[model samples]
Target: MLQQSSAALASVFDRASEDYDRTGAAFFTPLGRRLVEKARVEPGSSVLDVGCGSGACLFPAALATGPKGRVVGIDLAPGMVGRARRAAESQRLGNVSVQLMDAFRPEFHGARFDFVLSSMVLVWLPDSAEVLERYRPLLNPGGRFAFCNPRLTGQDGIPFVPEIFGTVMESVGVHPKTFFEDLDNGWLGAPDAALLKAGYTGIEVCDETYSLELLSGEDWVRWSWSHGFRSFWERVPQARLGELEKEVAEGIDLLRDSDGVIRIPGTVRYVSAST
Candidate 1:
């Protein structure tokens, strides 16, 4: 069952394809950006954006590398790749390109990057440690590998409904996994200590917790239902789904004050190592 769920998650972003760029960017959590900064690419350096997700992390990367350097974003979903390409073109960024490809099967084909970066996408892979080991051979010496590791953050910041997740599962006689895979074990500690056990060097890891604000309850919940946790919603009871949405909104309201601003707690783990 875990295997099937993992496989589905690998492909699930397709359902959120259309709204991903707009919604994710709007809700673009700060942790991802901080991770990219730690990568510290220089002008003319080559960079790879794994799980690019409509290039949410690419634009800043392009600017970081300047015009001489090139940024390539690879995503498993064809829809995301297409949207990324459109996004690059809209910004007229000549140095960045988006491609549809799997990180597990990196057919870079004639390209080597100075930095290989992934943000919040590693949780789905059971063999992420091995995957990083595979990436080492492709990086230029002194190049860095980095990603934003989450500590069960963003639930409160969500602009849509997730307060109904447990009820949604109960209604169907099932257990509901949260919007994410619950990778919280290592935001401050090594979730995957095996990463260093593998032959990588110059390791530095740290986590920071922060608060993120979203418009209101409904928008946050709707966005989560549409993008962040679509699979959870699909398996939920169809009849009582609206109730779940309402419950989610009510929960969000309770978390707020007289000013009506909803604040969600977020924790980010940032890790970087030399390849």
Candidate 2:
């Protein structure tokens, strides 16, 4: 119910599996670490990283759980899970394993986790509430579940001028519905107070915002194309895509400081609950 081009987005990530994991430093950005930290992993704890991506969430879980413990990463995308498996094997991380599994209908026997962590994935799922319900059975007593998903901020975004994306989209004449709106309608949150209604305890909810320092016009352009403007661009004329890119880059340049760094603000909602 939330994502519009989820299938395409999944494919894009799947295609970038290797690049996604190998860029360890960039992969586990401060934002990712913040999400991982919420799990409160301990030595000997058994962890499950749902929608683990390549290894962004998996490796961190492994480190937190330690040799005495173990981490199992799973993703609905087979390619992502496969990439995670390879990385674990390459790093000789005997305590870690990855599996291809559905985020909403994870196939596991009994309550098995000390902690479960998910980032960004929940916001894109159509049945996020049901997803949480499915996960509830997997969390053992005293186990916790934590997740991070962006909160839409209704702010005026970059104005399009002439850029790669704009040019391409203009040529083809495509426009995708792009807007930052409150997370609701099951994908983000539910009126039922789903978490509490589902019987989670010690629920802690927090707001987290990430203000990025865009290093270059290219970085800003790429970031916007991959994020907020993504769905919009897909609907834009193919030729206008480039023009939009140029426009976004130009907007970013105007925001850049003398040091050539442009900062943009973003926000997400984080929550951690225990059973």
Candidate 3:
């Protein structure tokens, strides 16, 4: 089951790599930087970014740790690691290195870190507590682990294309797994007690809402295609992908206001703790 899930995750992100950085830049990147910032990273500190997609947090973390410090980023997707490495090279970040590695079973030879950071990742795992416990030993004494994930409160964010697409597909007798199904099956909450059970102290979790403005339904569709909709698209028949995209776009179009801008709402909770 772990191997299958890992393959699915790698395939999803590998296929999304081309547009992941751009689509994620609007939100995921900022959230990752925030997680690193809250970790209180200082110069010469050793930092690890788990599930680091396209260097969103890796670059900022490298800068935060300065030239003397080391920042290592790992992702299950080789495509994402390639993209991140390119960005780091382009920026001449000699202190930062990205590798294709699994977050669930991260291994380093006699290596530990001052801070371990992840963002928008825990929600996809089947067991948040187990993952946290796995990471605990990698941290130095009193080292911190900080991460963030969507809160899923109220209306489960905007665009609403995934649910709509699932409905459309099911109506046609083609049942594809919906995005919410993944959320329902995976880590869903703040994991406060889980952190305690994982031997973490000084745990803090904060909830915040972020408002995003989309120019039109097309924009939202593009972003979704690059992020949340990747798995759905893969499950769909190749010949039916165009139809699905059109249907989802039409549904998203109705979400626009009189001024033509869509107000997409998102809520996330940040978790930080000392190991």
Candidate 4:
């Protein structure tokens, strides 16, 4: 089941690779930078970025580590790996390499990395605890592991933007409660506890809220299909996708401010621990 889920996730990301973080929305890139910041990556460090989609976290870490350091990024999606590799080459980043690899079972020598980072990836894994343990051995002594997850809030127990998608999905007779339920179940309740259980120390968890500004409702629809939310968009039948998008656009437009910007608020939890 885990392998099947990973394959499905890779396929979804592969399909989304072209527009993954290209949408004008200030979401993934900003969050990736924030995670790198929280990780406190330094020059000459050896960094491993798991699930490095489109080099969001990978590039920043590479920049932080400077020319003397080495940054390796891995992803299960071949398209994502290809995109990251091209981006690295285009930028002339000789110190960076992106490879197609499974995050759950990373093939690396023990204690090979000074830092390991992931952004918005753990919540999708069914065995996050075991994965945390698996990643621990990859970090060298005193090395740090850092990652981020959405801090779900609101009456429906999800972020505001996703709540809108759920409501729109239900309007089209496709229930999204199961999806959100699975999401809620997958995210760790006490990430620090999980880290401690995984034999990590010096744990730190922080939360920050970010506002995603969309130029218009149409922009929101485009941004939705760019990231993991694409899964929800894919659930709608092709014949009903247009109808769903139109309604979602209208629904999102209603919440637009006087300046015509649709700002969706979400909180992200960043966690770091030392090996």
Candidate 5:
């Protein structure tokens, strides 16, 4: 079951890789940069970016670490790996390298990295605490582990834009709860206990809010299909996609400003811990 889920996730990301962050959406790149900054990556540091989609966190970390440092990025999707690698080469970022590897099962030696970072990726895993424990060995002594997840108030705390889509999903018989069960289970809202359980210390959590602007409802649809939200869209049947688009557009239209743009507010919670 795990293998099947991983394969499906890889396939979805593979399809999304080509236009993942290139769709003119100001989401992942800025968030990635913020995460790297918050992580305080120093010059000459060795970093490992788990689930590095299209060199988001990878590129920024490389720049922070300078040419003398090394930044290795790993992802399960071949397309993502290829895209990141190509981008790295084009930018002449010799300090960066991207590989196709599972996040839960990285194949690097123990204590290989000064920092292990993941941006907006940990909440999707089935067992974030266990994954944290597994990744601890990859970091050197006093190394840091930092990651981000969507902030939720509770089990029902779906963001406004996603709540709009969740309503549409319900129209097609898919429950919104299916996507947030893990988060609702407490790993996302309260991760300190999990970090401690995973043998990490010096934990810090920061809350950040960002505004996402889309020119129109269609832009929202495109943005949704570009990232992790694509997983939600995949559960929607093909025949119902048109209906989904129409309904989503109508729903989004309700939030448009006088300028015909939609602004959705979101919160990201950043957590960092030391080995």
Candidate 6:
């Protein structure tokens, strides 16, 4: 099941690789930078970034660590890793390297890192506690691990666009399975206790709400197709995919503000812990 899930996510991300950053950087890049800042990385530190898509956190981390430090990035999609490697080389960042690897089962032995970081990756795992426990042993003594991912808020749950998309799919009698439909595999709760259970100390967790504005509702649909909500839409049959897309775009336009910019709602949970 783990392998299958990883492969599924990889396929979606791989397809989005070329325009992933261009389409969604307005929303994703800031969060990645924040996770790096929260990690408190310093010069000469060894950092590991899981699910380091397009080197968002990875590049900033490399810059933070400077010439004396090393930053390694890994992702399930080869396309993403390739893009990161290209970016690193183009910038002449000798201290950075990237690999295509599964975050759930990292291919490393011993506590080789001073800091481990992830952004919006844990929520996709089948077992957050087990995965956190596995990551604990990879951090050196007193090392820190930090991550940021969305945590659904209140009874409303999810963002406006995804909720509308899911409702449309059901309305069409598609009944496609979606990650948001199962919070266990797609969402996280208060994580400090889970970190404590995983043998981490100095744990801190915080939540913040953010708003994203697309040039228009069509841009929102394009962004959604490349980012967090892609997986849910992929489950729709190819024959019905066009219809679903149209319905989602029309639904989003209805919520646009007077300025003609579509405001999408989001909330992120940030966690930092020490070994």
Best by lDDT: 4
TM-scores for every candidate against the unseen true structure: 0.85, 0.81, 0.88, 0.94, 0.94, 0.91
Preferred candidate (lDDT higher): 1 or 4: 4
lDDT, candidate 2, residue 149? 73
Candidate 4: which stretches are off by over 4 Å? Answer: 1-4, 154-157, 160-162, 172-177, 185-187
RMSD, every candidate, angstroms? 3.6, 4.3, 2.9, 2.1, 2.1, 2.5
The window of 10 residues in a row where model 5 has the poorest summed lDDT is 1-10
Residue 130 local lDDT, model 5: 81
| Location of the lowest summed lDDT over 10 successive residues in candidate 4 | 153-162
- Candidate 6 least-lDDT 10 residues: 178-187
* Pick by TM-score: 2 or 6, better one: 6
Better of 1 and 6 by TM-score: 6
lDDT of 5 at 138: 90
- Candidate 5, 136-244: lDDT as tens digits: 9898999999998778756434653646787788787766555665465666778899899899999999988887888777788888888767777777899888888
The CA-based lDDT of model 3 is what?
0.76
lDDT of 2: 0.66
lDDT of 4 by residue, 116-182 (tens): 9999888776577789899988898999999998776435346547456778887766655655555
Cα lDDT for residue 226, model 4?
82
lDDT of 6 by residue, 1-275 (tens): 13137778788789878877687428778888888888899999999999998988998898889899999999999899999999999999999999999898888866489999998888766666678888888898999999988766655556444457667777755443344545534326667677888899998888887787776667777887775467656667888888878888787788878887778777788899999
lDDT of each: 0.68, 0.66, 0.76, 0.84, 0.84, 0.79
Score residue 264 of candidate 5 by CA lDDT. 84
lDDT of 1 by residue, 1-112 (tens): 1212434655678777887645432444355567668777678888998888877577778888889999999888777788889989998999999887777778866667
| Angstrom error at residue 79, model 3 | 0.8
